[model samples]
Target: MPTQTRRSPPDGYYRTTVSSLAIALSAPAVAQETTGPDDGEVRAEQIADERRENPVDSIIVVGGRIDPYRIAGSADLIDSEDLRRFDYGDVNRVLRQVPGINTQEEDGFGLFPNIGLRGSPVERSSNITLMEDGVLIAPAPYAAPAAYYFPAIGRMQAVEVTKGAAAIRYGPRTIGGAVNLRSTDIPADGLAGYAFGQYGSRDYYQGQAWVGGDTDYVGALLETYQQGSDGFKTIDGLPDADTGFERQDYRGRLAVHTAPDAPVEARLEFVYGRSDLEANETYLGLADTDFAAEPYRRYAASQRDAFSGEHDQYRVTGSLAFSDGTRITATLYRNDFARSWSKLQDIDFDGDGSFDSISSVFVNPEDNAGALSILRGADSFEGAVRIRNNNRVYRSEGAQISLERPFEMGGARHNLAVSVRYHEDEEDRLQNEEFYSQIGGDLVFERQTDLGQQANREAKAKAIAFYIEDRIEIGALTLTPGLRYEGIDLTRLDYAGSDPDRSNGPTRVRQTNIDQWLPGLGATYELGDAILLAGVSRGFSPPGPGNPDARAEESWNYEAGVRYRSDKVQVSAIGFYNDYSNLLGNCTQSVGCSVGDIGDQFNGGAVTVKGLELSAAVEPRLSNSVSFPLSLAYTFTDAEFDSSFDSEFFGDVNEGDDLPYIARHQLYVEAGVNMGRAAATVGANYVSELRDNPGSGAVAENERIDDRIVFDIAGSYALTDKFSLFARVDNVLDNQYAVSRRPFGLRPGVPRRIVGGARVSF
Candidate 1:
């Protein structure tokens, strides 16, 4: 008999090892051979080799390579190989290849992504859980989930997305799903490092470098990524001004671990990161007529608009594994973020003591000719153009622990895990306004107001969560059942603008408490080279610090799918439906909401969203040294309201009105040819028309974003074992289309861009 090794059970959320039953059930086409006394050692060595090849996968959401096929729900992983093919810095472009995801483009650079999973709302990506290295990365996920800051994608090693029952394991916002970004990891043994640089159109440049090594008892890593562009949009009357942005990110990691053969294996790690960004961007967009004539032109009123931000993160993690197949992990993390955006907020060109939002001016330009003329720099105006300095600071800190154990009973194997977390976050706002006058097509400073004149408030939240999950295996069938509880306390304090110091105490204070229980179940059955999966889960998204009567978004989600995999081909098709009992909408400046309405939540009554996701991939050998690889993904969604209601954020609402900003159809396709040393790929993405407001029937001309199809091509060639050259062309056809119509006027998509780069490894 073989020296049977006691293999630890797979984690409920992350890293796991392949089981013999899974191998036998999923890969029936492969031949199985009898094992000798050394088979256990050989299996352990194979697992070690796989980890060496992709260390970053250990901290991702979908676990190891084989877990995607074995999990009883929909999951996808974009490994380093896939990311290197296109070298996309914009997350929007990277996520388009994955099914069941919806993205709304803003700024054309993905600086602030609006991503939705399945049929959840896509506003600032607040309806989903976002993480980096298995930890929450949102600045203030509970107090202010709106993503004003996003990690740099150029430095990431992998991206994972999980939906259905598995998503409940990582929550606060489980209505949509969870997206986790994996960063560079310390080498297992020898020293390793890589450097990359790229230069492209519009004076754009990107560079990344990292180095890491592990000794007998210690490991360390350091990395940096930098990118900038001169921008493509031209500012009216200011041709020399650069409407570009610059970003810099830095990270450092240290790890301490016991010997590989220690009785109680343990590891402790510390990580720190910092990032800064400066951009001459704005929320003011062009009028309809101006957009038709010149889509990439910026209005004169927005010439002085700019944004600056800084973020810092610190984290510590510890893991312990016992010889009895039980594992425990704990983590502590903190994040700090601050930003200030100066842009046009309101206009009163006639000096009538009444101010109108910038969005309203563009909606009725004919009626506001005086304001429109001043905005276009065609006429001089006195002091009445208000430019707001929206300054805010955020802080988030949390601690969590998880334990997993496996046992056998009644001829069945069971994996059980429990987790607990305590988190606190806050958002502080201290903003003011500055008056400007238009003189000779140039902005002239008129007057500046004291701090806190515009807004002075703080919102905070403290929450505790508990989760438990069990995975039971019987023959070729696997079942997963999970339950979670969340208790949250929210509070908001408002100060009078006149008393910036708050010496007289807060003018008003509001507080609320909420408790919820979420449950989910998933099952998977294996049948001869194919697997069938189904799941039903409760979805939830908590409301921010708003009206006491505000209700959290609640829904029941159901999904069923089938997957087939062979040596040369893999295919999957899943159908999902989300039934909402109480849908919620949030107002923010990015959505064209007025200053007074910002941070407000509204009830949307009943709603229903149903969608189908299809994906396929195939690779065929054409010759002895050549192969062709191809993949396609498509999604169809129907999202609409089932009851009549009215809200300031969504305007007038009626039954059957479709939700805004979500397209009806999306498709992506890619094909590549790979030789021994050279490779090339071409990809295309298509999105159907989108509506800007809630309404049924034919979309109004002003509220519609026409359908668009964009093509991209990339090629790479290896010159040596450690060096390679690559080039990419985005928007190969230069198709012009409107990406969005919000916060002001029309915004255009990225034009044709060409880039060339090189990479070196050591």
Candidate 2:
């Protein structure tokens, strides 16, 4: 199956809130529970020695970051310690070490990430299910899951990525996988608190503070985190404008245990986040000559662009455990958001309606010299520039219930999980376009040529999903069989653009409903302390609402892997093949989709994605108080179109054409040392060149992003039992390279930056 709470609070919340509920409901079952910088991750990493087992192959305790050996698929648990080690402001930097996941950096600040997993389209991470706690976090996940507003990773306790058969239990739209961001839970025992502050290059500032404790009956927590920067890029001749962003987050939580050992637990949480950006960003790539001269240069056209938005989330969760080994959990949640990005879209050389493509002017300077000169204000020109206001509102709400019960059958032990969810989400587009006359590098807003509304429509989805999985263990071998069912309803309403206010200039309404059942099976065999496993599953992604020509993305996926662990080292390797019957692509504003077709879906009939993932980690004792820890991860992805087709974005494609923007190779490694209360670490991230268009044409070279390796280092020393000083340097070598060629031109990674901070706890 590829596809919520209380009073039906707001939009898209239904699509992202269920994932949040799953984590909270299972809190009690995971015995490694604690309160710290990142409560959930801390709990998993520091399970009182007595309960600690081989992290690689142990299932002694269940938690947010599930162990690799405890499942029939792949799962990675990134903890607070990892975050503390590097202290990267952008989550993308931290995820580079994770195998199988791909990152496409946009703003360098990680404000809006373009990510993909297992060869799925990474345009905007719409193929994956994102959750906080265990519920969905995407705005309008059903109608549109572009992830324009991602969870604030800076405050998450831990981030969990899960794939394979087990993921069926958490989706109505499951093709790639699921990611859960755990939050700081209310303490259960002590009155604890922590505060941290940091400063760095480009006037970057950051702060995070939280306080929480538990009493005999109730627990509560209050937290706040905020950050801002002056930005790294500089515009030619526009020295007064700052290309930076400011983000703020606040969260509150309360929990009631009922009686000390009451068999039942409940918790409620509220989160609010805000972001304001004055970014000099655009979708106009520079000519090779211009890029070679200065890749960080911003176009004069994008100087007035800005992106701003806010999000609010609310959820209530409860868990019940029976004496007979039966457990049940229920969660209700809501999430709502509204955002607008006014950006330069196109330019007209004359007062006529005809317009020249921005790509032509930017990519072929010699051919379009006149246009380039006019655009850069190096020459006088009379033309009009179109600035589009990409505005949208989203809402999602849902409720989910999970039940686990153990039973004995045929001399084998069986653990069963049954889950059901009801979800609904909607997206409303209300956008405007303002026309401006440019002369001598100056812009004059003209209302006479205004396009009142670019987006005047609504799309919505409602779904019911049910899943069942049974894990049977017979001696040294285990087998798991799972099934998921999804029933979905989709609808769309459109108004003529001429009627800017949507006041009825010709209305069009459409709807589509679908049902699907997904099945998967997996098995594992143990050889001493090592494990070997394999699985096959049906993967699917829903078609967009009211798209008559779009088909659901469906695939038959197969995977196999191995894992081994010792007291000092751990290793895991996996290979996956996704044979697709159809591939679907969703249009998103960030990727330059016109506001009129922002949520449209396109089809790439047949495709295949295959890849390998490898990970290794070691901890060696140098001496009693000195030890070195090392980790390495690598991924090889081969994604291509299986049949010939034509696309407006990709131009033309042939059989076996490589998918755009997906690197064929990625690697990351880190090594560190610890001496009692002091620790240090250094790491490197590498990605091979990738193309922006599918076909291998002459322009391919210019479209491919340059390959590069980035290095970072970090260290920390304890000043006292409850205080510590930390320092880090990102891009330590300061080697500049292209990270993205979209929205256009080469966007470079953050330059060399050094930051220092101190953390205090009580």
Candidate 3:
């Protein structure tokens, strides 16, 4: 298996909300619950703890940033603290619960998980906009780049996701939405930090410190973390894989607040991380449950492998306040990344007997004198046979800018934001001797050997976009309306490879796509402190044909919701519907080129998705001594393909089939208990069955996975004001499932596991 690019951040909130509610619900379950910051920066050298659990239902933004509530679109927020709670094995799993989100996990951790939102997968860059600290990360607007790195929550506050046109404030690529990760506040005084743990050999460590002086440049802030864990799997016939994983995160920042009366500020920020872990291989789904239970004898061979990768992202941001409530912000950044790996597999043909390939020796045929040679009758071949090799390395650099203005009226305030971004990425893809082995045994093997080659392809793209938004506030009402425009030029030149000849156009092609406009709107209402209401302006995703000159994709969405809360209770309910045009799906093998003739092709079409999300939470004291907290969330979704041709590739999938990966129902319930210094909680999340894909490639007919329920338990005890002990157990009951299902049908969920550890502060 190969190492993948940074997965989504562990900052997703599902686990934290469930865990907290579970402890609150237990009648006599005594435990403590906790909350962490979700906005602003940590002072230099200040150790900050933050979490974004329950991101979609509970989140607030200031400074005229994106407004998630008023936009009728769908969105969610993940806090930093929640990310620390899990073993942090796979970040994508933590994000799968968000509405309109789906994942593509090919051949396990060896490949990056591609994100799909609403009905738009990451395949086309024309729609979705991905940002870090408000800067676009992808080098190209209509093209998808594996996200660079997952920033540790140790230095972050929360991740806000704005879906649909409501996300227009960020720029043109936001047809589907935009993702913004907020940085933690910088401290002014000194140093701080915390620690915690769970079952499954999991542990967490973090620390921070600050230094500031008066009448001079304020240079302050330092933060670091070390985390590791052993994993779970109790079933037989399953690989006793080591859930061994480790991470190191470091950050330093310097701020200069000169001329206290002036509204100008400058900050220098740096971040770095390295990770090493075991890559879990997924079992391709078997034909039947009974078949899955049996370890069919193989040709005396099995396969196993492990991998690791490292990344670095650095940036400098400056803020300047001009006259008349206008401000300008800009950031310059560069990201560096690298990864390597290999696999060992025992081969068996006919499922009857195991035999070493005589060919393994042609390159290094050294040892072997046995019945095996005699079995081949000695006349056909000679000597040694044992192994095979597979190995690869990839890297990029980018810059961004934005401006904003504010307006106020009748106790209400409004802020408008606009921005543009550009990036240049160079990629190198590699494969070795293994390529020759696959086509070797044939009669033309000699010719193939002579044609063996090693090469690289350099792809460069330039994307530019600008957008404007108007936010209005009047008493209990907040309204936001916006529009965006975008343009791109993409070109690929093969240094050691030739462009395949095509019947419709020149074999070597050059293209460019430009759009003058894409528009959006959003609004929100507050009914006192107990009830808040909202709805979005619109949602859209434009398509991008792979050719630089292809047409752009497009889509629109509508949504409405409300949040009701008080000191003792909180409830949120939402309903949404989306319409998509020129939606992209599995393209013909000629387009994607990975699955042979089995893959579908991309084409212009329409799709609709409608769903409802409802959640409620209560905090009530039992009798007069015990406190209980309870919460529940459920989802109902109906998504389908409207009208499309290309039957040779899609078959009968048309008009009203549910979109793949969008579960019809997802429910979670939990409770927590608190008693002085000790506390505990338990919760369960149930997901209704959903298709991993709309069935594509060779496995389409035999593909179908089922609904599953997973239970989790966690607790922590405060030993002293400066120290604590904590532990958590996940996948209780040892339920077997998969966070990702492989193309061959294998289910790969983490096995039952436990993690525990301790922390201290000064």
Candidate 4:
């Protein structure tokens, strides 16, 4: 077992009296709540089996189920057991521990994930490729990638993140890397089922159950999760309206041998999700002073905001095995999503027809204090409020086929793979605006906008892609080289400000095509007892249609790392550099960008991102019935703009300025004790200060989100072989820290919450 040294605490004064924990008024938290790891790096069985093997041995990992030791890329695996240990219902909270990925909490609900991979823009997770069951899962990957619709992480079986040169197989946003979520596989043996539920602060509630079984010729699984909450923030003078959300998710799968003796297996799956929310969320945020005074308060202007949405997916998959180490797998899939949000947009506080966007008022509060105070019900104001009904419908479907074969040639071994995919996606957006007259903090319906639609447009893309890769091995060295080809036809029709129904005007249609070849290579060498790896890849992300001169976001990405593995300990260190020729950002209406429609793009000329990641874990062999587990992860990233350019979203930027919101340093630590059927774990996380704009030395008070440190603890006790009691507490420190400085002012992290529940298997 690996050993660790502990240091004693420094001598300090001890206060005579004690309190629960330090909490910020209206700050909503007592913790930094940084993400850490459990036993979630790999599958429980796989990790156990590999622990007994040589560290340098090649074995399939959860990342594409590819052999990690043989690949030249960086990958991280999040297993199911780890999810249970962390109670990972929030994707942003858990992914924080995964180095190279930066997360910004939007609305604190994990409802819409905003993540940037190695310096990609952290908006709606549009810069990276998102997949489920090894298939594309975004609402519209090619046609439009902004304003994403994220998946619920509570029900996922595993999450596989592959970065740098290793992500060549996935497109069209290869520059940021890929996140693939693997769903639970149906049982191949006897019946199995489990159910669990928990209740937390702010009326939070969660419950889920799943059952699966297999027969001689058929296998089936059924699962459902229903969760909801009455939100934390209350609106002034409107105590009756709840400010939270509710959602129900269902998934089912059936696999049939069809011909029991045939060499093929097939499965069909269906996934359905629906959610309704009456939230007080808005683009408006408090000023620095106001935040310091009341960080959790909501203004009266946004009392009427609400949202609702639905998503559905259907897929058919099959696999074939041949006699000589060859196999083929294929899938046909389709997804549909629709959403509508009714919220306040602009306010004419003085009835002056000269309206100010709510976002502007929040971002520049010092100049808009009069209007801000009036909107907060501090003073009377005669004005007309502008409300926009934002609605959109999306559809995506695709077919993919892949082939794999292994053979030996010239005294060496080689693994070969080939695949082809055709995908099509479309987005239809039609929105309307309604005017209201405000008197005494209450709104009276005035009239609908004479302009047909606040936002009206459609985008579509049809793409064909082919990929091939070869892995060659000689002695203790392995090399992999891969290539991918993408050809896409994109089209957009803008009825901007006109009715989508063609009732009020004509439409302007535009078309564009993009073709590119992306290449990647990786090498791994097994040393005396350690593993050395290196890789380089060409990354690509295409611009949406309608912009004839919009160049694709391209980069040369490089990575190198080393790893050591054993039965009791594992460690790894990796470094990556991404040199970008172009970076892209889209104006999102939700973020207060109304210069054009929702899908407009702005290009940032040149950028560079370099980072380092370190990780270690140890599980010492203690007594026959007791053992301890500890793990640590750290990240350091230096991201900056290489070219001086002006961005509509980020304002002005000079060369050498740090990119917005990319934390320079992050650290995570976790320790746990296991005694037979009972287990306890505690963890802490720290993140350095982050900036919202490019600036010189010190982080300007206005452009900075303060650093944070958070803690968490959880325990589970098994009463029998089939049942267990569990409890958890988050933000144990109750530290108040800024999680985001976008969409307006500071948005706080999740507040302190305690939950207890039971897990039962039958």
Candidate 5:
């Protein structure tokens, strides 16, 4: 209906003071009985008061299929037993412990991070949309749409983070939401299983077996895993000299449960991957007063090489319920990817050096009058000086359709839906040449530059979207709202500087022009059961039309949050403010312009981000099935950088500042004590400190990265009901930090490690 102008205030003020104190303390809350004192553990204190009032039932496959207090926006869910007590091998560090996720490191942890939301444009925010079951695995418009490229979150069972409800059934970049990865079908009857273990040279295994009955169908799932380490922190003298990692994943699902006047019901699915790794360089480079006193330093020894090479994804989704209440659903998907990488750089010289050390400077190649010496029979010159390589390949095909029916107005009771989608993304890039060897660099004096360049880029982007949604129920009141429209087409071809022994000539690459429209909207209100949601959306990324005058980045998100559950506890709170515009970066050369465009600038003007979030959960009833769960989440951000324009050029940018990896405050706390066999959880996360990178400059600054606080402790034991046994201790007060920040100006994060495991189900 496109019409909104109600800036806040008007939605269950603590549910009208808890329904006027339940009719003014109705009979002392039922004679204040319910004795306490762990007496036979009253169902573990009612499941810890239902996990602290209600963090959505502490996890029940996202509360019997969504109704997050009637949903308006903002969502989160992570189960499958908190992914094995947080013993993750980077799903971007488990989405940085939630709360507006942010992680964009340039090195370490299997390299390639970079995922920021809310503050928008963290270098092309694909508007956020990543699905798994409903299909849609982001390969759109080329590069960077990662789900940690599969190591199979031990065979994922749950992970849904909507942030902004439905988003018109998932489209238009979700405006800044959508993260589905549900994979636990369970319908073909028979067979089910699992297995796990930990602490360094780690071990993990998974399994699933399904068989159908009554009118045949099929199913499949196989998983494999490996993690290694006889090292943990030390170069040269070695100890993690070159980190380790390994993975192999596969999945398949088939369905056909139709009959009873069949109206066609079909399904198909397949997924596969092979990930490999080697890492070391978790942000090392200090000197700002030693990173203001210890920020985890170790400088030099960068080596990470990944090879996923081939990945195949396919889907056919289905839905067709009818009998006049009409309904139709569809989805067809495809994804293919290729990856390659190499990095080998080592250095650590500063006398007193001997972490198993040595150094050299010049040897052979010549000294015939260019005067040079320091080849002390040389020591640490491990060749292959510098090499940054990447070979990419991607392919995609898409299809989508959705429909629903039912109507009635005035007297109210409507429910309508619509959706459409079409997609295409093909990209190729190859750049190689850094087989270093320069004892003399074929030179006479000392003037040579070759920041190694030999590029070859290709692109083809396409997009089309459509959406519509409505839901209105009378009585206690329920109103849902939605809308979406999107269209984009971009292409690129730079090939860097098509080498012909370039002399600064053929360096003209630009292309871009094709962006139709983008839109979004949302709403929700229930009141009776305590629900209130809000939304406003618009998102875009457009650029790489092959550089054609690159300039396309937009954002608009305004949100409201509220959710309350009863039966013993669950609370939620959200507040957002996002408004950005044409923000892209890389305008090299001391913040000027025209100079290989540094990395390619953008960020012309305007930027704002306000935030507020709160979460609470409780479950108590210490008896029967024993339970005790607790959860707390809090977020507060005040991103900045407002007004702009002056031929851009960034640099100590003013008019507000802040915003460079973002961090105003973030927190997460958890407590656990379950006994449906055995369980234990202890969690902690607190982040704050980061700001600087307005084009680097300030007592020596550039992409600042220093701020720490991360703690984790886990435990599990089931041994029956399908097996289980796990353990974890990550950074467990190993302190020493820098969560993330490093673009060229290095300083990565991720240290302190320990893992243990055991899981088996059948």
Candidate 6:
């Protein structure tokens, strides 16, 4: 094993007293242990220990799973051990274990995850703050918060979620809380590395590797991950067509630091990452009857649908710590993303010029018999099927600086943090459409429109944000009060569809300016092995560039919870209420919006979302050589609109209409058996029925997504000190369930999958 030199804690006074609480309130943390070599585990353990002894080292919410009892608000950590047990590449599957989280799956895999926290809406995951290594990771978070490009979860080391007042420290969107993805870290000692490979059902395969080394003054790291699958869905009349996807990611890091004992220790690091994805995916779904007969079948018209994307990220971070207990950190980052998704948009059965949306056809199949026949490849159509290339490019760049200081005042220990950031982001859209005819179950190209004929626009935003938070401790009580301010300027430029080069200037220009202040307060009291926590926070979600008159989504969020921990058991329960003064919705193609209506925003009056979250974990030894570990998480939610409204996106709403796509109840359970070097685990998740549209009371047959339950199992055994073998079966019951009914028709969840892999370390 390699040896490491320990660095002194940031502040000796706080280290011996309330460092854990201070760290939890201030910064991001490495909150999980590694499942690699012995050295990797040791390094992870050391980092956790260091966090407990250093107040300024952590910069985000939530510390580690080992110390959730110390958190002052609702938070959770999905550590490495939990991730290794299932080896899931889909973020949707991993997040099911966390309470108070909801997901609407798309594309079977997690390619375009629709995530919601607390009571926020789950549309493209646009209502929450998303980050990686404490830096904002969403493409064009301000100009276009829709998450068309999400980080590859398989390359991450840990996942962290924070809610309520604890989440006030980060944002542009604070209503739904925040999610942070922690990437691999540079080794703390000599050379260290690990490699993992897996192959599974449906011709699926994945490979990942990382290597890193650290010296007294310098460190470097490199990592790569690749995955592919010949999807589980089959298209009509196309036996050889692949409904699969391929993805690749590469990252590199370099760092330089001063000597361990220097008066003012400092470190500077740089990171670069690139990723590419190509998927044969579509936004087409099936009719109710067709879905029941073949849940994993693709329509003949969607056989040519495809999506491709590329992303590049660059970041530089620097931090300095003074001997007198002051620390400052700064980061500069940039990201570029581009994607093109070509799919069927509409069809015209008659010779008339008017066209009908694909969703309309599915809703009233009898009225669109001719169009249905064309889609099923049972009849010939002439230039009726329209396919659009939804092309867009996004860029985000920002600089942030934060300072932390610990002090004592009025007989109370206090840790204060202040941060400021300047950010700019833009989204450019240049799209076109093509006509195709189906004859003899094959599509023939008719004519292609000029580039930019479908859409030609650019949205830009520049924002400045400042926030200050202070954590004060007296006796067994800790209180944190924070305030945040954001000022943003948004602009949208639209060009005529016939002018791709913009020689005649923009046809329309819109500008909007917004400023808001958010405040939060949290309190926690420790009593024996149990802690009581409560918080109240202001929630805000900025409007996109397309809507200059649209009001930002604002709410008042409140929560109270209790946590208890013993030697072998841990439990927590939280109750939360979010009162939305203004609920906002964005129209996108994924939500069954027409091409012309995409990017529009709708306002829904008053709304209320109340929920309860409960989680428990226990580990018991059955005998000298056997141990059983079990965990459970459950959530119950009640959400409804307080006022009636009408819009293109929300259809017709009543005063008591419930929010769509949000399950009333969700539960997850897991159990594991461990015997020395061998372990096996099983997990199950349950979701209650959901609505496809806003309504109350009884659900209509056409607007319901039935309840579902899924099970998964995994086992692992150590062959040697440096080698381990693992295998897993997902959806063991082989149940076919409807996951969503949007963008056209009914969609199915992932089918049964089996995967086996091995791990090697040095």
| Candidate with the greatest lDDT versus the true structure | 6
* Model 3 C-alpha lDDT versus the unseen true structure: 0.46
At residue 703, candidate 4 shows an lDDT of 75
**lDDT (tens digit, per residue) of candidate 2 on 1-762:** 011111222344435335634653454344322223243343223432212221111111264345555588777778777777876768798788789998888887888888888888887778888888888888877788888888667777677777776666677656677777776766657899999888988888778899998786777889888888888777656766688888888888877655555444333334333433334445554566766778666666676678877788888777655534555678888888888778877788654677655666645567777777656655333447777788888999998888765555455555677777888999888778877776556666775333445768888989878777877778878898988877777878877767766666437777776677789887888887688888888988888785666778899888899988778788989899989999987776556544236677888878899999999999999899999999999999999899998876555889988888788899999999999999999999999987877754433666778789999999999989999998989989988778877755567888898899999989
Q: What's the CA error at residue 116 for candidate 3, in Å?
A: 3.8
On residues 1-762, what C-alpha lDDT tens digit does candidate 1 reach at each position?
112112222233221111322332332112112223254334334434443354342433323453644477888888889899999889999999889999999887778899999878887888889998888888899888988888988899888888877788889998789998888888787799999998999988888999999887899999999988998898889998899899999999999988766777688999999999999998878878888899899989888899999999999999876544456789999999999999888888767867767787777777877778878875445777889999999999999887765554455555666777889999988899998888888889999899998889888998877777767778889998988877777887888888888787777777766677899998998887788999999999888885665689999999998988888889999999999998888788888876344787777878999999999999899897799999999999999999887676667899999998888999999999999889999999999999999999999888888999999999999999899999999899987778888788889998898999999999
List ranges where model 5 is wrong by over 4 Å: 1-71, 74-172, 175-232, 236-342, 345-386, 389-434, 437-449, 456-512, 516-527, 530-544, 547-564, 571-616, 619-629, 632-669, 672-681, 684-762
Judged by TM-score relative to the true structure, which candidate is superior, 4 or 6?
6
Clashes of each: 0, 34, 85, 7, 65, 5
- Candidate 4 residue spans exceeding 4 A from truth: 1-67, 258-280, 378-383, 450-452, 496-498, 503-506
Residue 615 error, candidate 6, Å: 0.7
Return the TM-score for each candidate structure.
0.92, 0.89, 0.71, 0.89, 0.30, 0.92
For residues 175-224, what per-residue lDDT tens digits would candidate 5 score against the true structure?
45656666655334455544454555222222333332223454555544
Candidate 2 whole-model C-alpha lDDT, 0 to 1: 0.74
- Candidates in order have lDDT scores of 0.83, 0.74, 0.46, 0.73, 0.51, 0.84
Q: Estimate the overall C-alpha local distance difference test score of candidate 4.
A: 0.73
lDDT of 3 by residue, 332-432 (tens): 77655554333222222222345433223211212433322221122212111112222223344556665555433333454556555565554333322
Better candidate by lDDT, 1 or 5: 1
Models, CA RMSD each: 8.4, 7.0, 12.9, 14.7, 24.6, 9.2
Q: Between candidates 2 and 6, which one is better according to lDDT?
A: 6
